[model samples]
Target: MRTIAIGDIHGGLKGLVQLLNKLEVRDEDELIFMGDYVDGWSESAQVVQFLIELSQKIECVFIRGNHDVWCEEWLETGEVNMTWYIHGGMETMASYDDFSDEEKKEHLAFFRKLKLYHLDDQNRLFLHAGFTSMHGVEKEVHKPTLYFDRTLWELALAMDNNLDTKSYFYPNRLKHYHEIYIGHTPTTNFKCDIPMNAINIWNVDTGAAFKGRITGMDIETKTFLQSDPVYTLYPNEKGRNKD
Candidate 1:
C-alpha cells in the first residue's frame, strides 16, 4: 500500500481536493494528514467534512496542529485569543457559519480527538509542529505539540541560518525516527530538509493560505505534488471573512 503524508492544509479545502485528485488515492492506500486542517482559508467546515468522508474510504490519520488546538480551545470556551485568531483561527470560525450548533459540536469533538503526534510502527513520526523536547518527553509536557516549551524551534532556526549548534538530539533518549514530517513554520523555499543521524526531518508548510502552493508528499516514493497558486484572505480585508 502506498503511504502518503500531506502537510498542513490550513483550511485550503479546494487545494486539498485538487491535490487529492491529482494523487488519485485508492482504497488500500494510507493517507496521513499532518494537521492544521482548519483555519487560514475559507472552507474549514468543508475541509472537515471532506476528511470525514475520506476517512470512510481509506486509512487516514489526523494529527493536531497549533491552529487546530486553538480552534478546539476557542470552540470549547468561546475565549478567542488574538495570537491564534490573527494567525488563522478567524477563517476557521467563519467556516462554521452554515453549520448548526450540533454540527459545530461534532466538529469540535473531532478536533479534540486529534492526536498531537503520530508514530507509525516503522518509526516514521508525523506532527504538525516539531518536538520541542525529545519525542518521548513531548507527551509529558503540557501542551507539548502546540506550545513552545523547549528550544527546538530556536535551535532549528539557528541551524537553518548556518549558525553553530550543539548536540542534535535532546536528552530524552528518543532516537530520531526514520523521518519526521512537520508543518507550522513557513519556509520561503517551500520545503526544508534537515538530516539528524539516520533520520531526515521535512518541513512542508508552503504557506498555501498566504497565496502560496499546497504541498503533498508521497512518503513511500519520496516525491511531492503541489497545487496551483490561489488568493488568500488578507488581514483586515473587509468582507474577506464571509463564509
Candidate 2:
C-alpha cells in the first residue's frame, strides 16, 4: 500500500495522465494531491472531472490551493477575480464552457470538500502551501495561511540539516510532524526539476504550471516518478509561462 504525494497539476491533465500511467497505481494505494488542479492549461475542467471520478475508485486526499480558492469563489458567486483572471483563471473558466451547471456545482462541491491539511496516522503532514504557526497546523490562527504562506518552506530551506530535534534551535513547527509534504512553491524555482527535500519537508511541485513536469513521490521510500515536461505535452499552450 504505497502512499504517494502528488504535486500541483495546474490544469495539465495530459501531464497528470502521463504521470499516473507511470505510477501504475493499486487499489490500496493512497494518493495525496497537493492541489492547484486548475488554472494553467486547457483542461482545467477535465482535470477536476477526472479527479472526481478517481476519488470514487481510490483513497484520495485533496488539499485546497490558492488558485482553487479563487475558482471556488467564482463557481459559487459567478464573480471573477481580476487577479485570478490574469494568472490563468480565464483558461479555467473557459474550460468549463462545455460543462453543465449541475456539473459545475458538483465540481464546486469537490473544491469545497478539499482539506486544508492532512495529518496521516504516521504523523506525516501534507498541505498545499504552508502554515505560520510555530506550534503546528492545529494551532494555525489564519486558515488561509495554510494555502498562501511560503515562510514554512523558506524556514525549512534555511534550517541547518544538522540541527538536532532535541536542541532549542529546531523549528517548533517541523518538530510536530515526522515528514512534511507541500507543493505551492515549485521545486523548479531552485532550478531542479524534481521533488526536493529540505530537512524533513518535501516539496513535490515541480512547476507543472510552466516548463517542469508533474511529480509523484512515495512517502516512505522517497522514490518518485514524473511526466514529460508539461509544456511539451501542450505545445500550443504557453501555460503560466506567459505570465
Candidate 3:
C-alpha cells in the first residue's frame, strides 16, 4: 500500500478533488494531509465537509495549521481575528454561511481533533509547519512552534548538502527523523510550483491559496501529482492573490 502526502489545500476544493481523482486512491493507501485545508477560495466549508466524509472511507491523517487554529477560534468564539480575516479567514467564514449552527459545531469538532504532528513507523515526521525542538517534536515546549516555526525549513535550506549526518555539526532536529514533510510555506515562494526537497525535508505546499496547484506525493517514491492551478478553477475570484 502506498502512502501519499498531500500539501496545503487552502479551501481549493476543486483542486483537491482533481488531485485526488488523479491519484486514483485505493482503500489500502494511506493519505496524509499537511494541512491548511481551509481559508482561501470560496469553498472552505465544502472542503471541510468533503474531508470529513473522505476520512471515513480512507485512512487519513490531518495536521493542523496556523490558519486552521484561527478558524477554530472563530468558529467556537464568534470573534474574528483581524490578521486571519485579512489573510483569507473572511472567505472561510463566508463559506459557512449556508451551514446550520449544528453543522458549524461539527466542523468545529473536526478542527479541534486535528493533530499537531504525526510520526510514522518509519521515523518520518509530518507537520503543517515546523517544530523547534532539537531533540524532536515530542520534546517541543511551545505548542505553536509545531505549526508556526519557519526556522526548521530555513535551516534545512541553508545547510550544506555535503554535511555528514554523523558529524557533530549536523542539526539534532534533522537527525531525529529519516525524512520530514511540511506544507505551510509554499514552494511557490521560491519560484517552484512542485514539491521541493531541501536535504531530507520535503515542502509540499505549492501555493494553492494563490495561483498554484494542490500537490500530492508518494512518500516512498517521491513521485507526485499536481492539479491545474487553483485560481484557474475559480477564475471569477482572486483567492488570496489580491494586491
Candidate 3: count of backbone clashes, pairs at least 3 residues apart or interchain = 0
The alpha-carbon lDDT assigned to residue 16 of candidate 2 equals 95
Candidate 3 C-alpha lDDT tens digits along 120-141? 9999999999988888999999
**Poorest lDDT segment (10 consecutive residues) of candidate 3:** 128-137
For model 3, state the Cα shift of residue 51 in Å.
Answer: 0.3
Global lDDT scores for all candidate models: 0.68, 0.95, 0.95
Which residue segments of model 1 deviate by more than 4 Å? 134-140, 146-174, 189-199, 232-243
Off by over 4 Å in 3: none
For model 2, what is the alpha-carbon lDDT of residue 94? 94
- Clash pairs for candidate 1: none
Model 2, runs deviating above 4 Å: none
**Per-prediction CA RMSD (Å):** 4.9, 0.8, 0.7
